[model samples]
Target: MQAAILRDKSGSLKIEEIEIDKPDRNEVLIQTVASGLCHSDLHFIDGSWSDFAMYPMLLGHEAAGVVQAVGEDVVGIEVGDHVITCLSIFCGHCDRCLTGHSYLCSHRQEVSDRPIGKPPRLIDGEGNAVNQFTGLGSFAQEMLVHQNGVVKISPDMPLDRAALIGCGVTTGVGAVFRTAEVKPGSTVAVVGCGGVGISAVQGAHLAGARQIIAVDLESQKLEWATQLGATHTVNPNDGDPVMQVLELTGGGVDYSFECIGMKQTAEQAFGMIRQGGSATIIGMIPIGVNIEVPGTDLFLGAKRLQGSMMGSNNFKVDMPHLCELYLGGRLKLDEMVSRTISLDEINEGFEAMINGEVVRAVIDFGT
Candidate 1:
């Protein structure tokens, strides 16, 4: 199959005909339908963050597809099913999974990839092993993943839109709906108005937030945020975003979500929340950058700063429900798709995202 391979940090992806091994006993093969370009992937692609990712890696996780085949040991999912893939691959018996925190599953590395002795799932034409980013690698025409990594959704859900729910949608919506548990009638502020930010805005609205404030430097994103669910918008160009949010919300917001993954924006999220209110950091901030917060506020104000990983999602349960919301027209997935391109246009898609010219650029492999 043809796939986009990133062989270096801060380099353009090279399209190559790669070899994909057959599914393992616990694997499922999916014909990729659509994959969403996410900022998290950009972190690794642009060299801002690199930890587990290896060279010549396949770099995409936000995706939806039709199941092409499944190994004998794979149950609960069958060929022809529509599903959304997640990086939160879990082992069901782990303490975290048993305790309803599968996102923190202890055996993730153990289960998500092939066993050490096994042949690699993907390889170059010269027969070199290629790493699969996050073990999903949805940037390709097909994805072979552990059964635990994908959640079957209603086939009625469009694959292009379902792709967003895989990462950006799930992370954004989960941050509001599950992690912070924003209560109805509360004031909310979301920093960043990209695909994930817009999802956060919509999630706040769905949770019945009295006022959803969207913050961004781009007027286009602010406008898109308002269209999705932001009751008001704040452009940082106007002035200090924290001060702007404070002026609009009377003092501060009840809940604040930092989705940009920047040190300054993370601090701003903390500042925008009122005393005793919670601030959730949902962005993948660069590794090794320590975030400093006001020490006195912890004792005097009772404010909380927490990090949310993939919205603390249990994909099998959360994704299906998300699909229902989108299918029912409550969640606005249609407006989230700014553009659709073919797999060959992958580089252009990433450029658009880096330029902040799109909300979510989806690569339609079938295109």
Candidate 2:
């Protein structure tokens, strides 16, 4: 199989032909149909997340595909089943999983070169083994993943659209529903309008928010937010967005979600929350960056700051439900796809993402 491999720190991904390992007893082999090029992948490429990674790694996490083969113990999913893959694959017995926080499971991955019982998954020219990013590695035409990483979805849902459910959609929608638990008629302000940001807009809309405030610096993204379901839009550069949000909502919103991981935007999101309100940080902020909030204000206002990872998702349950929501027309997964490209065009897609020009540029792995 040929995959987009990142061997060095600061360059575009190079295509490499590599061998994929066969599935072990509890794993599954998937013929990848579609995958999304997400900003999280760029984080690894650009050195934002340099703490925990190995070189010559296969990089991709959000994907959907058809089951080509299944290991002996793999149940619930079988050959020909269509599924969406999530990186937060959990061990069901862990404390986090038992407490209904499977996304935070400590034993989500095994610390070994090869999966238990399966052969080593990848190797380089000198026979050096490489790690799979987030353990899914959907950048290639096929993937060998643990059963917990995949959730079977209806065949009627387009695999290309289903791919978004794995990351951006799950994170955004899950933040609104599972994390912040936005109430009906509550006011919401999402500060970013990328793939994840736009989905947060849609989630807030579907949750019955009376006023959805979409914030970003780009006019085009603001427009996209409006079409997705935002009741109003704000370009931060236009003026003080905090003041504008205050003016619109009479004080501040009940819930504020910071989808852009910048320190300034995180502060802005925190400032826009009303007294006793909650602000959720959905963006991946860099490490060692301090976020300063006034202690006096926090004490007086009773405001809260929270964070969400992959929408705090339970893949087995949440992914299927989200797919149903999309199938029912309540979720706008199709609209989130701005364009689709083949494996060779992956760099071009990444360029578009960096320029803030696309919602999501999916890789049609079938191509």
Candidate 3:
């Protein structure tokens, strides 16, 4: 199969014909139908996530596809089932999984990869191993992943839009519904208007927040945000976004989400929340970068600052419900996808993401 391989931290992905192995025990082989180009994938390509960089890596995780085959141990998921792949692969026996926090499963590595001595799931023509980013390399025409990493969804759901639910939508929406448990009638602010950020805006809207503020530096993105669900849009270029948000909300919002992975934006999210409100950082701020907030406000005002990983999702249940929401005309996955490109145009897609040219550019594998 042809796949996009990030051979180094040179900031570009080269499309090449790679070899994909068949499913192993407890694994499922998927024919990648649609894959979303996420900012997380850009992190490695741009060297922001150097600590986690692995060369010759297959760089996409957000995807939905048709099941082509399954290992003998796989159950519930059969050939021809439609599914979304999630990065939060978990071992059902793990403490975190049993505690209802499976998204933070401590034993993910056990299910994410094959045994060390076994042949790799992906390899180059010369027989060198190629790492699958988060164990689901959906940038390729096919994805070989653990059964635990995929969530079966309704076959009627459009695969292109369903792909977004695999990651960006799940992360953004799950942050509101699961991580923060954002209450209806609450005022919310989301600091970013990209794919994940826009999804967060939609999440806040779906959560029934009375006021939804979308913050970003780009005017175009802020416009996109308002069209999707944001009650108001904030462009940092105009002035201090934090102050603007506070003024708009009369002091601060009930909840704030930092969808941009920057120290400044993360802190701004903290500043935009009410005294007892919570700020959720959903973006993957680069490794080694630290986020600092006022300690006095944290204790005196009872403000809470925390991080949400993959929207703290339990993919099995969450992905299916998300599909239903989309099918029911409540979740706006169609509007979230700005455009769709073929696998060969993957580099241009990432470039658009870097330039903030599009909300989401999906790679349609033509499967």
Candidate 4:
């Protein structure tokens, strides 16, 4: 199998021929069809989150594919099923999973990875072990992952678009539907108009938000946001984004989402929300960076600032529902994909993402 490996934090991905082991008990082998290049991956590539990087690692998580085989212990999934892989692999017995928050499962490491001392799931030509990022490494032609990490979806769904639901779509839409529980007719503002931010715009639209404001520094992205569903666009280059959002919404929006992982944008999201409103941080801010908010505002206004991990998703149920929405012509996944490239072009894809040149660039493995 050919996979993209990040040997170190040098800000590039190298495509190499690697070997993928057969499925272990409780695991599934997937012939990768499509995978989305996400900002979270860029975080490690660019050294923003360098401390978490495992060198010689296969790096990609948002993916969808056909099941090639399944281990004997895998029950619900079988060969020939179409599925989306999630990073939030969970242990069913964990307190978080039992409490309806499997996305935050505390026991993922216990189940997602192969036991220590066992042969690695991936290996280099010299037989050195290569870590699988988040245990899904969909940038490769094949993915070996735990059964709990995949969600079976209708075969009718297009694999290229279905790949988005694996992460970006799920994270953005799930933030509104599950984490924030955004009410219909609510006023919403989303900072950053990239993949996740654009998805959040679509989520707000589908959730029946009366006013959807899209914020970004790029005019092109704001245009894309408007076409997708944003009622208005805000470019910080013109003026203060927080003030512009406040002026547009009459005071502040009912809910705000920070999709760009910057201390400034996260704080601006807090500023854009009205009293009693909630602000959800979906982007992964670099480790050690702190975001400061006024204590008096939090206390007196009853405002809430919180983080949403992978949209607080329960992929088994939420992913299938998202697929139905896409199939029903309600959710717009086709518009979200800006380009489709092959696995060899992964580095260029990430460069485009860094430049804000595309909403999403997917790698079509042609399986």
**Using lDDT as the measure, which candidate wins?**
4
Q: What residue runs in model 1 are displaced by over 4 Å at the alpha carbon?
A: none
CA RMSD of all predictions: 0.9, 1.5, 0.8, 0.7
**TM-score between model 2 and native:** 0.97
Q: How high is the CA lDDT of each candidate model?
A: 0.93, 0.89, 0.92, 0.94
lDDT of 1 by residue, 36-56 (tens): 999978888888876656888
Clashes of each: 0, 0, 0, 0
**Candidate 3 global TM-score:** 0.99
lDDT of 2 by residue, 12-37 (tens): 78888888878888788999999999
Error of 3 at 348 (Å): 0.5
User: All candidates' TM-scores?
Assistant: 0.98, 0.97, 0.99, 0.99
lDDT of 4: 0.94
Native-referenced Cα lDDT, model 1: 0.93
Where does model 3 exceed 4 Å of error? none
- 1 or 2: which has the higher TM-score? 1
Tell me the lDDT of model 3 at 217. Answer: 88
